[model samples]
Target: MEVMDLGILSLVPAVIAIVLSFVTRNTVVSLALACLTGTLIAGQGLLGFPTLLKTSLGSTSFAWVMLLNTFIGIIVAFFQKTGAIQGFSQYIQDKKLSRKAVQLVAWFLGMFVYFSDSFSPLFVGTTMRSISDKAKVSREKLSYIADSGAAPVSVLVPITGWAAYLSSLAIGVGVIATQEDAMNLFIKAIPFNFYAVFTIIFVGLIAGGVIKDFGPMKKAEERAIKEGKVLRDGAEPLIGKELTEMEPYPGIKPRVFLNFLLPVMMIVVIAMGTYLTIKSAKTMEAFLFVLIFMGISMFVQGIPFKVIMNTLTDGVKGAVPAIIILALAYSINSLSKTMGTANYIISVSEGLLTPQLLPAIIFIISAIMAFSTGSSWGTFAICMPIALPLAFNLTGGDVTTLVVASFAAVAGGGVFGDHCSPLSDTTILASTGAAADHIDHVKTQIPYALICGGVALVGYLVLGFMSI
Candidate 1:
């Protein structure tokens, strides 16, 4: 069957997905329905389930990502099971640091966990939440700090899993001469990533007391300060109360923090180590290693092998929802691209695409896709193909600066959406990591994210004209 462009129908899947997610608050059901809608459109039939799953999960290119992400979830559960996560914050609490120092440490750890954005929240948010709570910091504040640290820092850092994936994509577009060239261009584009840079700086400023938290964040902070309520009275945390509040298993070793830090350090070391050697990433490797270590550690601590397996399963369970969401996120992106969603948007914006406005336009559109879809990687996948080619052609394939700006726009815009969208995995993980109410985290964070997003918009406009 010949598939029609469907004009605006190309966008229906994403819209339906987002609306369902918001209304139902169940990402799995929402994404599944969205995928079905798009698959039906793309295949022009009701029997596209296999095609949909293949596009989302069975694609060799994305299979690793889904696995890598799910393993991170397992590792988070491991931390919970081993009592490592608790020990991390407990170790920090031992420092008796000031409130600002604690926030600063949390912010820095987000940067430190630069290898994987998924792991960043699980490690930093989970580790720092208790310390922040002890310091009278709201869970909203904790999630914001974690969310900001996770994607923003990973996107900027060249050694991260994010960079490797993006670099491979950039090279595949045929614009760059080689993967090395793509890597260099990605590094050069970092300074122009306004949303990421500004978001990071904004968090630091808040941590340093240079800027006050306003909007919902302020109220949450005040509630924490005065009422000693880290969470709103009726808020529901994403990770269950039993897990977040669990104690070390019976006869556990002296250094619970070691259990946390060792596996975390290995994730970084292994990812960077292999990335340097083979140019293949190690997110999955690290997660598997952590899982094995946790199981053994727990078993050694007198827990039966069966119970240890249960703990491992529990960690994977935390990540399962996220992985399912990720698969659908991919499916929607494929459907949108196949349907020409980005091209449709670009086609409409043709009248507005001056050289001076290209960066800003790309940034805005990228942000829209990411926010709507709740996946920065998906936004990059959708928009980069369209944006890069446009940048290449619009500039006669000669201007390096314009290309860099466009690259920055895509990356920055994706982060902007990921930052604000309640549906984003990074945000959801942030809520779980901090043990905050998911919607509350979204509510309190939107205001601050938008503040930085506004700054990024104006900056892109200025840079666009400067490149001209």
Candidate 2:
């Protein structure tokens, strides 16, 4: 199939997707419509939509992400069933930490559970919710801490799924032949991942009270402190009623190490150990192993097979929402590639883009793309292929400072946009975990994310100029 030159028309799908997302606040519907529009614009007609869906969603990479999310959901349900999550929270509550201390602890815990974006926000928000509430911390504040710590922390580490996916993208580009090479490049880009670095530090500063809360968050905090109301009047938390009302099995004691910490550590050890020994991180394998281990462990502890199966089933059900968004995201990305959206943008900017300006421009574009799509990984899938090769060409195919900055720009921008998007799965999960209203979480978090995004843009500009 020959690629058609749609010129400026290629922008239609992404623009329509972005505009519709804001209007509907429905990422799945937005992406589906965008793909349909792209298909028609490419002259593939109505039937082309199904053909493109098969071509896009049928790939090995899409299957890997879908399965990984399912396994993560199951593990999360396992934690909930065994009461390990609540047990950990109880332990924290027993410490009798002050308001500030609870916030700081939640921040630390979020970074500690850095392996999965899906897991980190849920874990931090759920584990810290009761303690934070007792400490008079607002649910919005807790959600912000969880949301900021999730993708930001995950992207910084080299052993998790994020690292694996990002490094894999850099492969087949100039000089990034193997996983090891791409991983090395990712590490080098860390310091330049300014948005993530700033967001993480910003959360800590606010959590520790070193920096005063401002904007809507400040109002929420004051309400929580002065009125003892963790939520605004009539605020509806994003969490389902079933989750809020759930109780651990009767007569079954919770063991944090056996039920939770051990499984988490296993994932880290297997992923990190595999990367060190084999030069390839087996992230999926690690998740699969943990899922199996947890199931067997629960059974040995007297959890009936039927109950375990039910929990697994519930986990799959929970993952269905995110999986739907992910599948559509993959489809839109495929449609974008086939329609040459990235190419058109590049072609139109060829004369305007200097090597010294590439990093800043790429950062802004990637951020916009991620914000519109509401999926950091989806943004990564689309932007990395385009941004990396452009950087390579601009830098004479060397792994120069400009190239590294461009790479980091894409990673950091995706995080920023994902952090702020209400349609984002991680953002929604953060609200659910903290029992915060989904809209409130988005409203309160955006000011902080924008601050970091501004700072990151400046850093990119500086780095780009320095490369000259």
lDDT for position 159 in model 2: 74
Candidate 2 local lDDT, 174-248, one digit each (tens): 988997899899999999999999999999999999999999999999999999999999787765444454567
Quote the positional error of residue 95 for candidate 2 in Å.
1.0
On the 0 to 100 scale, the lDDT of residue 24 in model 2 is 67
Stretches > 4 Å off in candidate 1:
1-4, 16-66, 172-175, 320-339, 392-396
Model 1: per-residue lDDT, tens digit, 1-468?
233466777778888877786577665687788878887877657778557677556676468756765676666666666666667767778889988899999999988877777778867777787789899999989988998998999899887767877777777554587878888879999998999999999999998789988999999999999999999997767775445655556666546656777777777888788888887767677678877776777677777888677765666666555566567666766666677776666567778877889989999988987876677997887777777777777678763788888988999999998788765778877887787877788878998889998998998899888876
**In angstroms, how far off is 346's CA in candidate 2?**
2.8
Clash count per candidate: 1, 0
Model 2 stretches astray by more than 4 angstroms: 1-9, 24-56, 133-139, 160-185, 219-240, 374-400, 422-440
Q: Against the true structure, what is each candidate's TM-score?
A: 0.87, 0.83
